[model samples]
Target: MIADIDGNASVSNATGKPLTKRGEATRTRLLEAAEVVFAEQGYHEASIVKITERAGIGLGTFYLYFDSKQSIFEALVIDLNRRVRHSMAEAMAGTSDRIAAERAGFAGFFRFTAQHPALYRVVREAEFVSPEVLKLHYTRIVEGYEAGLARAKESGDIDRRLDPEVTAWALMGMGELIGMRFLLWERDENGLPPAQLDERVFTAMTQMIDNALAPRREGNHDD
Candidate 1:
């Protein structure tokens, strides 16, 4: 499970109570089931029965935590939001430079995408199922990215001219689209997405980010 900045266990139930080991496992199972079902069926067609069935739980068990289909879907989105952020944070940790952090962060994102292909599809459904949840998904990502970029700029790690919030959104847009095209769409002979980013493409993309975000040199004339 993910944790707060203070390092406390972050797993909780619908009542906001810290979960027992068993409760945490159950919630995780339901969310994982929802991920697969939502990605396969989309929100409009995916029902609570399907989620519970996939989760191998009875109908009554679902209501113990979530009230309805919409509730679970929203919860799923929130859960995914936490998870992806953690993935990015963990990857960027201890990297030597801002560009290195960016490359590592995007690598984490694509790794999650390859394993949980449901990410793109479920987030897209949030546009109709719950617009606020869609915004929540994006804003959470931007919050982390903006904070990191702000620090990097202050430390002379990245271009000071770049606005942290704007740069965050731009970099997020780049990562999502790249994951969609290269990771989601690329398939092997067995019709499965590759488990890693292509090395050449990763290097090229990181070079572009380095150029865009690198601090301007004193002798530089190009805008």
Candidate 2:
């Protein structure tokens, strides 16, 4: 799970010079190619030539956007993180409340995961290939999530006892594992992951979330 906190893409090239429209497009092409190549071949096996070949760009052109394979790999992680966060935010838009927002947001996440299964592999590889980017990926998602949870807590929409930061990480972990099981593991007869998470699993997951986050009643007591 990842999201761009700043919502800004790089406007310059590797040399610290502003990129022209064409240059930006080429950079995007390289990043896109890197995403697939890295996902398919682990960082140890992936090469600049492979990425350039996949992008149909020359070897020399690759250096203009990324100084090395590691650089491009890091960039791809950020790119995927930004895009996935955007997908969640887009789905969450106009929801009535935090609970609704959670449902929509998770739905968006699973949808993107289905379309871009590379996110899981590439991110996992980042743990070894570039630990810092891996941290950035999770931190970015949790930052936004914590902010939202804090707002909900202030509004009394969620359990006041819940620590926003802790709850945010917990919920993110739940979503991550659930997506891995239902979206990444399951396959159709066509040998592709489902286009969306199963409604039954979604319902069960949300019910659990609602139970966890719902405010406690004054008279309610549990041993």
Candidate 3:
């Protein structure tokens, strides 16, 4: 990772010049290092020095691209979100079926989280502590789900009787909570083998969605 000599919040190069190929490479290194640092150590605990060291850059160089460790962490989060949004867009664009889109999108998310468990932990944990980040992340995801739910309802895949916004929120919350429970919260005893996380999460999520979408009993007020 090439460290920018100038302390600026832009992802520029070491010379404090425009972002060339080398500059972009340096920026990528910084973001990648930030991801690892934030994942291994919580945001508050991570240091700019550590991040720079991880990126193989000097502390001054670190400052050139990011004002502080917080900025770098935010950049990492933004990058992750961008990747997720891109993946979802690709899945949706490729398919006309809502169910297929949801399944593919969720599977992509699951795979991404599985591969970057540490980074996911950093972002997930940061949400409550960082309202700005939370809002940004939630808005992107919620909008996507709402749009998806609308499509599903139109296609007769989802129950049009239900409020699409509310239903989408419920489904999103379920998937997130379940992912956290099975992926983030797993200790030694609770941890499934790495290979099983995807299948287990998918099965659990599918079952939960199925149960929620099933017709309620006459006396049941439960969702």
Best by lDDT: 2
Q: Per-residue lDDT for 71-94 in model 3, tens only?
A: 676667767776666665765677
Clashing pairs in 1: none
Q: Runs in model 1 with CA error above 4 Å?
A: 1-18
Q: What does candidate 1's lDDT look like per residue over 42-133, in tens digits? A: 98899999999999998887876677788788888888877888888899899998889998999999888888788888898889888888
User: Cα lDDT of all candidates, in order?
Assistant: 0.84, 0.86, 0.67
The stretch of ten residues in a row with the least summed lDDT in candidate 1 is 1-10
Clash number for each model: 0, 0, 1
Give the CA lDDT, 0 to 100, for residue 16 in model 2: 65
Question: lDDT rank, highest first?
Answer: 2, 1, 3
Query: Which pairs of residues have clashing backbones in candidate 2?
Result: none
Error of 2 at 194 (Å): 1.2
For each candidate in turn, the TM-score is: 0.91, 0.93, 0.76
lDDT, candidate 2, at 127: 93
Q: List residue ranges in candidate 3 displaced over 4 A.
A: 1-18, 90-93, 186-201, 210-223
Ranking by TM-score: 2, 1, 3
The predicted structure with the larger lDDT, 1 or 2, is 2
